[model samples]
Target: MLEARDMTLTELADQVGITIANLSILKNGRAKAIRFTTLTKLCEVLSCQPGDLLTFDPD
Candidate 1:
């Protein structure tokens, strides 16, 4: 989605008030959880729904 939006990690990190490393962790799907506030900010900035940012894979 970031690539599709032409947004860089650094740019998003700054916009989201998070460190690049933390954002990278979420971006890489290595994050065990995400704060609702952070998720809200991401959705606002990315102009997307939460569903767009998350996937449910039962594997």
Candidate 2:
């Protein structure tokens, strides 16, 4: 998704109003939580729905 947007991590972070380090944590899947406000910003900036950014794979 990140690559598909042609956006660097830094660029997305800026657009999403988050720090690069925080975005890195989310990208690496180490984030224990996410605020709805932040999630909304991410979805908006990424031009994607929440479902597109997240998946439920019970594997």
Candidate 3:
């Protein structure tokens, strides 16, 4: 979605009121959890549904 929306991590973080480092952690899939509020902010900024930003992997 970032690619499709032409958004940079810094830009997204700024827009979402999150820190770049924290967003970077999430981007790297190192985050163990995400708050619903954060998810909602991301969806609103990215104009996407939760499914659009996530995937199911049975690793």
Candidate 4:
């Protein structure tokens, strides 16, 4: 989505009010959890739905 939007991680981090490193963790699928507020912010900045940012994977 970031690539599709032509948005860099730095720009997303700044716009979403999160640290770049933290955003990177989320981007790389290393985040253990996410706050609802943070998710809302990311959805807002990315102009996407929650489902668009998440996927269901059977482990």
Candidate 5:
């Protein structure tokens, strides 16, 4: 998604009022949970829906 938008992690973090490390965690799929507020901010900046950011994986 970031790639599609030509956005960098640092830029996202700055726009979302989050830290690069935290965004990095989400980027790496190491996040256990994401707050609705944060999710909304991400969608707002990236011009995407939550479904665009979420995926269902069965392992």
Candidate 6:
């Protein structure tokens, strides 16, 4: 979504009020958890729904 919006990670980090390292963790799918506030901010900035950003499938 960032790329689609022509946004850099740094820009997104700033917009989302997080450090680059934290954003990288989320971007890399290495994060074990995400705050609702953060998720809301990401959805707002990325112009996407949670379903567009994350997938759930029980194994």
Query: Which candidate has the top score in TM-score?
Result: 4
In the range 1-59, model 4's lDDT, one tens digit per residue, is 99999999999999999999999999988888899999999999999999998776666
TM-scores of all predicted structures: 0.91, 0.87, 0.89, 0.91, 0.90, 0.90
Q: Would you give me the overall lDDT of model 2? A: 0.88
Model 6 earns a TM-score of 0.90
**Count of residue pairs whose backbone atoms collide, per candidate:** 0, 0, 0, 0, 0, 0
At residue 33, what lDDT does model 3 achieve? Answer: 87
**lDDT for model 5, on a 0 to 1 scale?**
0.92
User: How close to the true structure is residue 43 of candidate 4, measured as C-alpha lDDT?
Assistant: 96
lDDT of 3 by residue, 1-59 (tens): 89999999999999999999999998888888899999999999999999987766767
- After the best TM-score superposition of candidate 4, give how far the Cα of residue 15 lies from its true spot, in angstroms: 0.3
Clashes of 1: 0
lDDT of 5 at 47: 98
- Using TM-score as the yardstick, the better of models 3 and 5 is 5
lDDT string, candidate 5, 1-59, tens digits: 88999999999999999999999998888888999999999999999999998877765
Candidate 6 lDDT tens digits, 1-59: 88899999999999999999999998888788899999999999999998877765454
For candidate 5, the clash count comes to 0
Clashing pairs in 3: none
Scored against the true structure, residue 2 in model 3 reaches a CA lDDT of: 90
TM-score pick, better of 2 and 5: 5
Identify the runs in model 1 with alpha carbons over 4 angstroms from their true place.
Answer: none
lDDT (CA) per prediction: 0.93, 0.88, 0.91, 0.93, 0.92, 0.91
Which portions of model 3 miss their true places by more than 4 Å? none
Ranking by TM-score: 4, 1, 6, 5, 3, 2
